[model samples]
Target: WSSSLGGVRLINAYGPTETVITATCYDVPRDETLPDRFRGVPIGTANANRLLYVLDRHLNPLPPGLPGELCIGGENLAMGYHKRPDEEKKVFVPDPFRPQGRLYRTGDKVRMHGNGLIEFLGRVDQQVKIRGFRIEPGEVENILAGHPHLETALVAVKTDAHGEKQLVGYFRPRAGSRPEISEIRAFMQKQLPPYMIPAAFIELDTIPLLPGGKVNRRALPVPEDLRGQLSAEYVAPRTETEEELAAIVSSVLRIEKVGVYDNFFELGGHSMLGTQVMSQIQEKFGVEVPLRVLFENPTVDGIAAAITEALTQSIDEEELAGLLGDVTDLNDDDLNALLNDE
Candidate 1:
């Protein structure tokens, strides 16, 4: 029977001459519904006197949901491989708990998903961490697949020169139609939290498949190399006074000298930072800009010009002072006196 279509907990045993008659067996359940591309569980007992321990980097047993590497220990553990003692030494580690014994470090990363179920995450080498958060690309891809319009999606992490990591997603449309970037962004917004969402989305006609008939994530195209990849890039600053406003944004945002061609949120800016940028722009430019300015200009140069324009068209000093004074007096506690045409 074919591997994927089979409805049996099949176990095939094979091994090399030195490894002895294969003592390991992988269990594939009948009609196992492994979501996405997750494989089935492993089926191997502690051969007589062996031990299996799943541990984190700190050698402590991880909680059920937390992922960790699997270590195998016991008398059944193999001896040194040929004259490659150094290579053997790296794979075989001395167990801290068990005295006078070593364990083979299987590079597999897995999570105990409870109820006697252990879920394989991926290889430890493939795990990518960002901002002190351990992330599995498969988990993000699975979340994206939950969207109604998205037929399939794959997620990967891109690292810049400064060692900063960002998530990028590649997806195929359900039908023979092209989906707008805005629509995909909005759809992801509803399904995932901000950190989990892809910083950039790339739509494709089909996901590349490997020779083994699995999604070839490594072959996915990279995100476009847009100069200003943020929301601040689209708007252009219009006035000279706005030019000065751009300086303040460049200082606070710490970006590479922003211009009208840049974008605010696309430069990895957030709502809180937007408020600070706006406040500084208002103070330095002597103008009160709206919170919507960030969404409108989204770039230092653009926001500066917006402030300058708003200032130029604003009311004169006398009218402004009168308005302020009226507001101040209106707050006084003589309600009846004030209401009686005071």
Candidate 2:
């Protein structure tokens, strides 16, 4: 697009309010193709009299290609926030790299390219921990943006009715496209591991944006119910085992209904919750079920089948134990006769 402007130069500027204006600038090259790994345009190197440092949580400098919190130092930084001492202390701190300067933590996650250009990953606060896995929503959003049916996508961590944190994907479908939640879910499954997948996907006509054109996360509607997010259509439990298994899954997930084909992980089930489900199954069925059984067969029907098999094995073991006990009590002549019969 810049090529059409003739002598015009397109510049990408990046800075936080605390930086007292633009701290970095990138002269976007015309007709330049960015590598596939870069999620967005590079914010470029620091401007004159400005210092940019990408550091980890411990204030240690991170190597290039590693995402970390962006800290701005040197003459461009503000003198902390007014009348907000507590908040100021958290973000503005002494620079570890310099002897006489302070760095304002931008709370922006970014990584430096090998060529020294800085690429913005996302906001540090947007990173979330779900099911023991720390996830950057921007990473998932980047993958979602590649889907042919989606025009744009945003992922955020939302608390469900049960007070559990879940990743919910909000997306706008491409023009003239009405993509199903199941199709989106399948696309995500192919690109990401189970833990990285969003628990629910909501279709939005237009994602709310602030005046600056950034996503207005607070404006995104809370899903009234998550049943619509399931990849499979709701099918009520038909068998006694299915009914029991469905009850367990519903209780664990804090969702009202579970279907025979509904996947456990897709319904927000994780390793911790899977353990609880397995424990309850063992107590109810009086048989041991391995943890991997849930991962292999996450649906209610699949779990019910595992439980049924476990129960059958238990019964068979008991019958074998009884036969052994009878043999133990047999006299020497009877034992010999039994051996001969066998």
- The per-prediction tally of clashing pairs is 11, 0
User: Each model's TM-score?
Assistant: 0.55, 0.86
Error of 1 at 318 (Å): 16
Per residue, candidate 1 scores C-alpha lDDT tens digits across 94-143 of 98778998877776676665543555556677667665556677767766
- The per-prediction CA RMSD against the true structure, in angstroms, equals 7.9, 2.9
Clashing pairs in 2: none
* Among all candidates shown, the one with the greatest lDDT: 2
TM-score of 2: 0.86
Model 2, span 131-174: residue lDDT tens: 78989988888888878888888888788777878888899988
Off by over 4 Å in 1: 1-50, 80-90, 127-138, 145-152, 159-165, 173-192, 206-219, 225-342
